[model samples]
Target: MRAAAAALAAAVALTLAACGSDGPAAPAGGSGGGVTGDVTVFAAASLTESFNRLGEEFEAANPGTTVTFNFAGSSALATQITQGAPADVFAAASPATMQTVVDAGDADGAPTVFVKNQLVIAVPRGNPRGIAALGDLSKADLKVALCAEQVPCGAAASKALAAAGVKLTPVTLEQDVKAALQKVRLGEVDAALVYRTDARAAAAEVEGVEFPESAQAVNDYPIVVLKNAPNKAAAQAFLAFVQSARGRAVLGEAGFQVP
Candidate 1:
């Protein structure tokens, strides 16, 4: 009886050991239902401040994931992406610019409008010029800066100016909104037409003037994942985070209108 009991006990131990070994294998590094590695994003210059904050928040939420950014004029970024620049995502200040990527078949899916921005006349902190409206920019004595027509801010500025029936020339045509705003900040120009959110971001250096014509020139901001993304899983996750409630809150704080 003792011998039989010992054999049965040994068999039970072997069965238990086999069950433990067969239970699922440990998750592999970087591929176990979790995002990992780097996600590269190409975004418009206007999104610099808000997107920077969003990038930090995304990295914190996903351990071992890195967020890299390339911020520039939406038109420029679109050219780069179409020319084969490796990027995981693209966020543009205007649907027209986003369409460039879509037309080139570089976007993985249809881009979504995430926010809206309007043109605002940015001036020195003290409003020394007394520039109250779009017509004010037409004063011959006033020097102004504007973004290049290829840029979203510049296009919006054109629309606002046309809407207001103002035919003013700028002292300089910058490549991006920040450059135009910089001209105002440095006092090189009396004023610049920039996005309301940008003026708010640089509140310490400039003040935004609201004009009725700006209502006619609001630009829609769109974002999409690249078709050839190296880290597609992480890219999709980052896109989701940008459209999430937390993302809307951060953008709202930055003065972007949720779409």
Candidate 2:
């Protein structure tokens, strides 16, 4: 009789589990659902994780809506937007990059500050080199990687370094922030200057070193709907979601400072 009762309970439990009464349905990928349409976003590389989660939420909130992203260095993404890329929105890691898009008339409205980020020294976990400050990165023996000055992170790095009046040659001038971070993660370089959010995002593989110079180059992340958006309404809604309380919480959790 006990065995029979256990089997019946198991069957009932299985039936309830299938009904989703215990928890919400798993989203196609991550989180929120609403209107159905396709919206393309050109975002900075540093925004990859947070934006991906945001995309899932946007899609869930707008049922049948597809939120696609082109995540790259802001400079590259800005160039694409200027070259007539069919993007529904633009979320740049820096205001300078966003202004480039707006100045080109590629965006529809004034850009809004969704989040802010700062630079940090990214070293492999355990910091094998025993490096701590900005000055340590300038050591002749350290193989440092930095983004090219044309990119957002690169520009910020340059400004921060200049604020300290310390100049050091990097072993490589990576084209983008992620690439520079990767150089450090792959043990190809001893150090790299990348966004604080990115460093935190890669916490398992890297340790972020906070330097005083970073305060001199805080980056403002701006987001906006595009002029040629195929689904402008959906795009605006998605942008709104990023500025919403839930969105702010998600971004903050990812190490971004909510604007």
Candidate 3:
């Protein structure tokens, strides 16, 4: 009788547990949810890989949420956001670029600096040209690529070059960091000026040449939720996740400086 009663009690406990709020059922909008809805993020190209990874992690944590990123030059992204593109968040590679958004009254609040990146020369895996220093970029023979002067990476390159008193005549002015890096990968150019994080993330395809002058051109990455965000709650939640331990781990592993 005692054994039968104990078995009955165990079954009743299991039934109650299954019916509780902690059951396997999803929270809202389905069987999985913390925040649901799509979030569009306009970020700099340098944050492409890291932000994409972070987006996946955030979706897993928040569930029911979808992350869509528009990665390109910070200036371009800023222009797009101000031009009426519906974006939930904006993460720029440079503070100046971020201010463009805030000045336009498109940003929700003061942006937070999440990471910092420095410039580096991205060359082919073998670095066949044997480009050694900043001076080598102006050789006039090595097909070098540079970012468009208006972009953050280009601004940094300009500062670094000005400090060194060297002028680099590039074969192409890429629209974004990835485009510049592409010039090196496709053998279109011998080298390119890109963020160190970009080179590290693309280590499988390119090699980074560390020069001393890049120190003077470090750029900070700032993130903010837009004032007209499609999903303010989701955007804020995503921003917090990016500054969380997991996000920091991913960004640090990608070679970004923690802010």
Number of the top-ranking candidate, with lDDT as the measure: 1
TM-score of each: 0.87, 0.87, 0.88
Question: Model 3: per-residue lDDT, tens digit, 6-26?
Answer: 345445546766887343443
Off by over 4 Å in 1: 1-33
Model 1, residue 37: distance off in Å is: 0.9
- What value does the lDDT take at residue 124 in candidate 2? 96
RMSD of 1: 12.2
lDDT of each: 0.88, 0.85, 0.84
Using TM-score, give the best candidate's number.
Answer: 3
Determine which window of 10 residues in candidate 3 has minimal summed lDDT: 23-32
Worst 10 residues of 1 by lDDT: 23-32
Task: Residues 1-259, candidate 1: write the lDDT tens digits.
Answer: 3234434544554675688743222222112234656889999999999998888667556545678899999999999999999999999999999999999999998999999998999999989989999999999999999999999999999999999999998999999999999999998999999999999999999999999999999999999999999999999988988888888888989999997
Question: Clashing residue pairs, candidate 1?
Answer: none
